[model samples]
Target: MSKKRKRVSRRRLAGQRVLAHVGVHNIETGEYKPVTAARRYIAESGIVPPALVNVRRNEHTTDRFFWGEKGLFSAQYAEENHFLFPSLREIVDRIGEENLFAGLEALASDDWEEMEEYEYAFV
Candidate 1:
């Protein structure tokens, strides 16, 4: 018999801000694509894990991706679920995506190191 998984409620902590949006991007063409396109690209390209591309959402938002054995996932999501995959945990520990991408605007911007540091600090 198969074990049923419990459905967990998605809740936000106080002061938490919702992301404006999430989507994929084509680096060469500089076009933003839907999430569905990301999945399709991963399947067709057969890219290796840990390979990723970045996309700029706006002046304040930049999205980062990590290619996994299963497919592409946001760095934040990969960190949150790293416990489920050993490879992911190693990548998160080594790359520190939160620190790496924070305040780093996309497209030739290298000011990430100048930004003020902040912690996740979930309650």
Candidate 2:
């Protein structure tokens, strides 16, 4: 008799690393393929991608998102691009506990003045 195996769903597994590799033998030949790799990680421990709880400008990228005043849960590009657990503990492990908390606080205040002060120096 054949044995029956249990089946699993994609939701039960974490998102696979979205990666790609490309190379060209010669640029003159018009082969300009570009290589790519998972620039960030993903987490699908839930039935759906984590809801976007907050958003803020990267200071570097200037990407706009829901600010402190606009309290609403929406999927921001950044969150979607770097999806992770919907809990603080999980997020802290990736971004570091200190930075994670600071980010939350900063977004809560909708104040980027402090971030802006250092922006010029980075340039």
Candidate 3:
């Protein structure tokens, strides 16, 4: 059974990412040497990862809980689109984990499982 607990106020879901799918087109035979090369590029370029940007101003503010990295927005795109790493682990690692759960006394539900999954997932 799901246990009910007091809801914690969060600005947004932790480790949320704005996914940007850069489409690919068929190029010359020489350009697409191996199909797997594209996969390698995706893995390395970090486009697939949850790339985050601080959005909030007043970097000195102490009350803010989350990193205020503003994301890049195009005039054509919707405002809801934001960027983040592929998972929470990356976000925590990028921004010190200490800040993430600093005030919380107890760990959140699924915290352990989420961490485990993040650890095993490929880069």
lDDT of 3 by residue, 19-82 (tens): 2222222212234323243333434554432232222223442111121223222212211222
Name model 2 segments beyond 4 Å from true.
Answer: 1-47, 53-86, 103-123
Please provide, for model 2 over 1-123, each residue's C-alpha lDDT reduced to its tens digit, 9 standing for 90 to 100. 999965432211111111001111111112321111010111212212222221122333222221111222222322322222233224435555354334343223323334334322210
Q: Which structure among the candidates has the greatest TM-score?
A: 1
| lDDT at 16, model 2 | 16
Clashing pairs in 1: none
lDDT of 1 by residue, 49-107 (tens): 64554555556656666565566667566444433434544543565656534443442
**Per-prediction TM-score to the true structure, in the order listed:** 0.37, 0.18, 0.25
Q: Give each prediction's root-mean-square deviation over alpha carbons.
A: 15.2, 20.1, 15.3
Better of 1 and 2 by TM-score: 1
Candidate achieving the largest lDDT: 1
- For candidate 3, report its TM-score: 0.25
lDDT of 3 at 104: 41
lDDT measured at residue 28 in model 1 versus the true structure, 0 to 100: 30
The Cα local distance difference test for each model comes to 0.43, 0.24, 0.32
Q: What is the lDDT of candidate 1?
A: 0.43
